[model samples]
Target: MRKIPNNGNLKMTKVAYPMGLFVCLFIYIAYIKWHWASATQAFFSITEAAAGARRGQQAQGPLGTTAHGHKVFYGIMFDAGSTGTRVHVFQFTWQPGETPTLTHETFKALQPGLSAYADDVEKSTPGIQELLDVAKQDIPFDFWKATPLVLKATAGLRLLPGEKAQNLLQKVKEVFKASPFLVGDDCVSIMNGTDEGISAWITVNFLIGSLKTAGSSSVGMLDLGGGSTQITFLPRVQGTLQTSPPGYLTSLQIFNRTYKLYSYSYLGLGLMSARLAILGGVEGKPAEDGKELVSPCLSPSFKGEWEHAEITYRISGQKAAVNLHQLCASRVSEILQNKVHRTEEVKDVDFYAFSYYYDLAANVGFIDAEKGGSLVVGDFEIAAKYVCRTVENQPQSNPFMCMDLTYISLLLQNFGFPENKVLKLTRKIDSVETSWALGAIFHYIDSLNRQKSWAT
Candidate 1:
């Protein structure tokens, strides 16, 4: 390079170097400022990527609204049942009062076919896919990475043909990634639907001595489903309170306290009604003729056990009377003699009053009667009260497996229970969030990130 000229006796000019560097530094800082800004702060950043973040902040569109009053999390949940599939979608959020309480955006039922093992998994996939697509369209917001679809299978899955079950699950997994959870509806219902969240937590705490499980020491919970029923129990805990919510304002809970509990999933409560229809002895019987069969106590004044009984029933949408007391006595007698569980342990437990109709009745919808004059069977919510003489006679037993699956163990762990001690509680809430599935999916997705992990 040829020197243009010796300026001021070869003194170097600072302008060229400093001026160029200043321009470069200005550009570099601008770039860093733009790209380094957090997604939450992208609006203030001047980078192109920051602009991309700002796109998520566009003012409420003509027909759309922000979920967090900012961004939204749209998610899917399925109540897979034997008779049909119920799908629900929601925008997960915890900004209470900021957004409308979740209403079922979409409730769809897909009926493929009837079999213990569903042979129509392939056929059902399209319905589910359609439902999913509709869910995306209905959510109104596009940000949903935080809320993944929660897929659960209730009792119907067991009846599904093995190949069909595997294929359906595989398809769901492929479509939803590791986010799909195939769980029992009973599990999902209690976790999400009833006051079961508090109930489960209370029971778990009572068992560990962190809370009290006392009183009649007879804690029980009954959850009825379309295909089955679950009964759980531990020691009952009683407390006296003057102020509480409307229902508990002056109420008694059966399983007020928790203990090492037991949970039994019966495959035949609601399904049995439908299944019995196929049996000749149960459904093929002749209808009652006009000739009345009168006995010595048929008179109104009769005081016999089965006589002078009045039954309240609805037929063809009309409420009518039948011999309910007789019907109840007969039903009770059958249950007392029937073998629900074969194990000596289960068989030995005292027969508490039947919480058949009321216990968890709402989980499943009302059962309908058949055309052949079949008895309309619904899950009766009843709480049985009985002395456990036979159970006491047997050897002491450990808690049931279902009790080990509760969220209490995790809460206890968070509460400083050693891992060993926590494990003793026999439950590990599936990844804090899993414990809250379809029923609580929205709530958990909205709150999980904010919750401090126990270990942390």
Candidate 2:
């Protein structure tokens, strides 16, 4: 090779090419390192935020214990409604003279008509144990079967196919062997949430008052559930009313009346109500391209005859002038009122309340809007404006007071009871629905400690 001397003004092309490539490679590696560092920092920040939240939860517990206590009780509850399943786990301590201290909590979601137990129990445990596992790294405590686990299912579990429902229960037992178990309808759950530890007293007051006023020894309570509704008709005795207004009956006359109430858990009612307008040619939308099934409750009504109409639902841009069946299914009280010829006799019956998981209010809101702006309930084509009044009662006295969650009123009429008192209490109770499970756990544990103290 011959070496050629060049002027300093221009470098050779071959030498410049390699230098450019080297610079490009160095820049690319540096960019990747910067991105990796940013990503790593972001991940740690998220983790720290989560940990800080958990620490805040732990700080809410009894002093010298939340950060150090070993005897922690974990309560887990699931309320499966017509719309969805909700999972909640709360950590607490049962210490003397102090409130059941809440240390940690978490939640998860499941379909409305499904059972929580059908899902894997350990997987469905909301990862509370995982958090505890990490906590054990710093604090000294044995994780080997030390914490008590409480888990229970309600409402939606009862709607599953029998075999499936039982399987779900078995799984719950397998996962949570310790702690007392309680299962029942959503009514009791609503009662607990709304009544705020006063469910028993309120139930007693309503039942006795209703029985006394009706002058019947028997009474029936029909509670609407999401997947299914319940009709509980029992023999109740007419007792004395706590207070009676002038011309208002003071006590139930000596009438030993047998109650014929039904808590008809119609698996179809909730779904049926929505379908009626679209199905059965009632709302006149020309049923979508599929098999249209009328709920059993609406079977007779649809079978009788199809009196077609094309009524437009103004609000939702849904036009349907269908027959009565489509519009009426949404108003259950009317269906019952018209079907039962002995309406006069049942008129005196006191107290009707609807409690379920699905949003009855939202469903009816759509139905009423489809009916050109009103729904007919109990012989009244109540304009949509007044629809919610029936279930929750009209908020006319104070527009701020009506908290009706549904368009229809399932409770009773004319009981001479103080409406304001009942409503105020009901609203106060409604406010606690979300906090019920945790509140129940807290209340139950507190009661146990109090009873133990009295004995000692």
TM-score of each: 0.45, 0.38
> Which candidate wins on lDDT?
2
- Say which candidate scores most in TM-score: 1
Segments in model 2 whose C-alpha atoms lie over 4 Å from true places: 1-74, 80-83, 91-105, 112-147, 177-225, 228-291, 294-331, 334-407, 410-436, 443-456
**All models, RMSD in angstroms:** 16.8, 22.4
- lDDT string for model 2 (325-346, tens) is 3343344444334321112223
Worst 10 residues of 1 by lDDT: 381-390
What would the per-residue lDDT of candidate 1 be over residues 1-456, giving only the tens digit for each residue? 985877864445656777789999999999888776664354233222321443433222111223325443455676565565556665432232343233334555576422222444455656666666666665533333333466666555654446766666665555555323322222222122223323333333333333322343332333434445444444232221221123322121321222344444545333333222211112222224412222211122222121110111111100221442232233333432342332222222221111122221212222221111111111121101111111123311311111111111221222222332201111122212112123334333433433433336
Error of 1 at 333 (Å): 5.5
lDDT of 2: 0.35
